[model samples]
Target: MPFSARLFCRPPRAARSRRSLSTRISAGVTALGLAAVTAPALVLLAPAPQAAALPNGLAATPPMGWNDWNSFGCNVTEQKVKSVADFMVTSGLAAAGYSYVDIDDCWMSGSRDSGGHLVPDPAKFPDGISGTAAYVHSKGLKLGIYESAGTKTCAGYPGSLGHEQADANSFASWGVDLLKYDNCNGDGTSPQQRDTTMRDALARTGRSILYSLCEWGQDNVWTWGAGVGNMWRTTGDINDSFGSMLSIFHANVQLAAYAGPGGWNDPDMLEVGNGGMSFTEDRSEFSLWAEMAAPLIAGNDLPGSSAATLSLLGNRDVIAVDQDSLGKQGTQISSAGGLDVLTKPLANGDRAVVLFNENAGAATISTTAAAVGLPASSGYTLNNLWSHVKTTSSGAISATVPGHGSVMYRVSTGSSTTTGTTHPLVGASSNRCLDAFNNQTAPGTKIEIWDCNGGANQQVTSTASGELRLYGGTQCLDATGGGTSTGTAVELWTCNGGANQQWRLNADGSVTGVQSGLCLDVTGGDQASGNVNGTALELWTCNGGANQQWRLG
Candidate 1:
């Protein structure tokens, strides 16, 4: 997790030593040669059985809460934690969905008891950890405990290296609802192994603790974290700076393919209340994290937070996207001129889109429904997540975004088609319908006309890029063999996401390819039902003939 930049930050408590620069370089060269010999045969490990699922199906969506790491750090105590929980309720954070009050490092005594059980520092937590957990739970919030997989924590305190079961059982006895297992001072196991051990131990204790793997981003955690924990950090600790926040966002967004219901790519705790960033940057940070379906954990002091910080942290409209239940992380659709557009598909065919501008000042960014992967012919209703404003969208939406700020929208597709409907095409001349050949799905399947049967094979749906999908499959209406000739058959083929597959649904009911200036037509203006299937559909002149007239719902 933190082994790269943070591993050697301080020497081990008992392994004190130093080396000259030449000696260090010499050792590095030797280690490089050893690594070269062993790197290719890397051991691909899966989680070791016990950590496979949440104890009782927790974290169906990303976890939302407040942790003490960024704000209080080693200064965390029972009183401060209780105060934070009080603030969580009074400031409307708990009502807005925050539920956990986490204690970071330095809560344990320097030495374990004779029985080797961790002892809470009496100087800080006079009521002990169990008492603190009771206090937190009484305020209607859950408690999260922190531990390291190593022999000693980053702060040189007792860690859970050889005491996985003991620590897990103790946390369970203390009523821990979440466990943030960190990586420091190793006890000879790989990060994966270490994390899995604790997960298995948690299972043994019969507690439904939400496991959060905070090994930083080491060992490519996204690849295997789903089987190990509910969420895993995809970056090192985030500092209260624009660069740290942006870098973490970029790193986590690129690994979205590995995230889903049981697992997520964490970008560390929130820096919103830390006070180094402007309001615009703070809003962008939270908005983008929600867009990416990241865990919504606040790592700030809620007791003394300003109204701006509380507002940014407790915005439910933005939080809804993160907890959408579909759990699909947004993807970057396009980036240019310091603006980026991302889209995430939600349940029931709705989509959430974010237009972000990171330029020096406010800039106008615009995107068409097609660009963001919405059906081209249908109309959508757009709702701004931040402003709670709703409006109708014809085909495109544009807004002026302040620097380091974004405009978010939830778009419902196919709700505003003309005549308030969506159906298949019907040829006016032949009185037949365009259908996939024999309801077959394969390359070069010719699109022909048959009697309207109200079957799925005959239906057409517009795509975000203007492509008309064939038979609700990956195949799109294509120009046979990419032809530009006058008589090329309109056939179905696997969509290559190209201009040849894109079509424009003109208000005159003409379906024309964006690249080719040809119209979808019935061959030779055939009128007979039998002749409709016998003759092929072709690209022809854009005349308003009865053969060319069709219905597109």
Candidate 2:
């Protein structure tokens, strides 16, 4: 679906090369404790505060469903969609949380009726979309239709540009529960204005329609999209290829902060079972998509799909990560030479870690619990979602991943009293403590070096799971926007267990971020004479500088 032979005005997105970065599990056990310690009584923390949902009351979590574009494209028919809905229920996809049976572009006729109402192709949809919706509803599933905001859809069908109200009414009358509004041959107006028009029109119909904006990530939709639609595309269309899927993944993963409850940043539909990639690649795609908390709109042949495809799609553990109550999108903890680690914080205070390998051969990927943001414990449990294998580790989580494959683990602890130790991170050069600016705990509060005052804010805990927490494990030291480049600022934020929050105190006294592999440095304080108090902290190349050296007790 990434390309259409009869394409419209939309231009294809250029490909992007993967970032060069590597992962290091680090000798965290030595840094935390050189000797084996007794396990503490397990006591989990209360769930984190839930994110705000869109006022429209739809998609409190990312929507999971099926779209026909990637499979049948313009060949969609009422029978095909209805059969797919049936397959969704029988195949356990509906029970697994896939509800929408969407018919993308070309479902309508080439032109509108005299009354300006969009018409369904009689031959392909003899009973019309309403009839199909009725059948889908009887199966306890929702129906979704696609339309373009311009004069025509990608397949050259009539669009809803000037006929927003009429089209919305028709859809609402047809019992459509969701609408995928795309950008094709749009009017000269801005995408924001055009998309908002359809949004308001859908709302005016008095139906609880889930609006999906498919502008292909243009106009910075993620920034203002929560106010307009349930989910907005964060990239161009995806095809059933590893390269294409990987490109879209890179494009959408960095926009994690823009996605959560109510609205999400869509990275297009799933390409599993399409045969363009190997089974390993397909599983990797599913794992990465769930990790990112992106919508799991499967776009493949249901009846003809292999059992392995169905099993992968029905993996409840992975699906749970996608539907996690916290709605936090996972971020890259480390990636280099095709080996990547990503982690997402669950509502139950657990972390979901994915060891992904993009190389041509099997490779070993590693990280620590403290690096992934788990509370320090004598031991942690790792639940492999794909293999259904349960294992225990002191703090290290490592796996040999196949080429273009991934290993996802739900990392948690059995109740423990040894949560972690809190102490000051005193700069070896300045002899000052790393402090949160003004003792504030708000996200993005400045992280600076300050005089050692023994304030609670100065107490930093290097948890077994790799998080550097402040204020009794309430706020974490985070890399701004998960940037890996030099000079990325470090700040205080709620402990979301993201890779950016994971840090390592090396044997030589240098502190590095598990995600960026960059040393935690006092900005402009690379020399023996460190910067003055209130000097901000940033991630910089590891040079073994005095400012980058910290002593913890």
Using Cα atoms with residue i matched to residue i, what is each candidate's TM-score against the true structure?
0.67, 0.67
Superposed by TM-score, candidate 1 places the C-alpha of residue 412 at a distance from the truth, in angstroms, of 2.0
Per-residue lDDT for 539 in model 2? Answer: 95
Any idea what lDDT model 1 has? 0.73
lDDT for each residue of candidate 2 in 1-553, tens digit (9 for 90 to 100): 3232112212222211121000000111121121111111101112233234457899989999999877786778999999999999998889999999998877888789999999999999999999999999999999999998877675567778899999999999999999999876665677789998999999899999999998766666677888899998865557668887776776666667778899898888888888888767888899999999999999899877654577578778899999999989998878777688999999999999999887878788999999999999989888777644455789998886667778888999862322276778876446578999998988999999998899988998778888999998889999999999999999999999899999875533467899999999888875434468899999999764456766563
TM-score of 1: 0.67
lDDT of 1 at 249: 69
Residue 125 lDDT (model 2)? 96
RMSD of each: 19.8, 22.4
| Model 1 deviation from the true structure expressed as Cα RMSD, one decimal place | 19.8
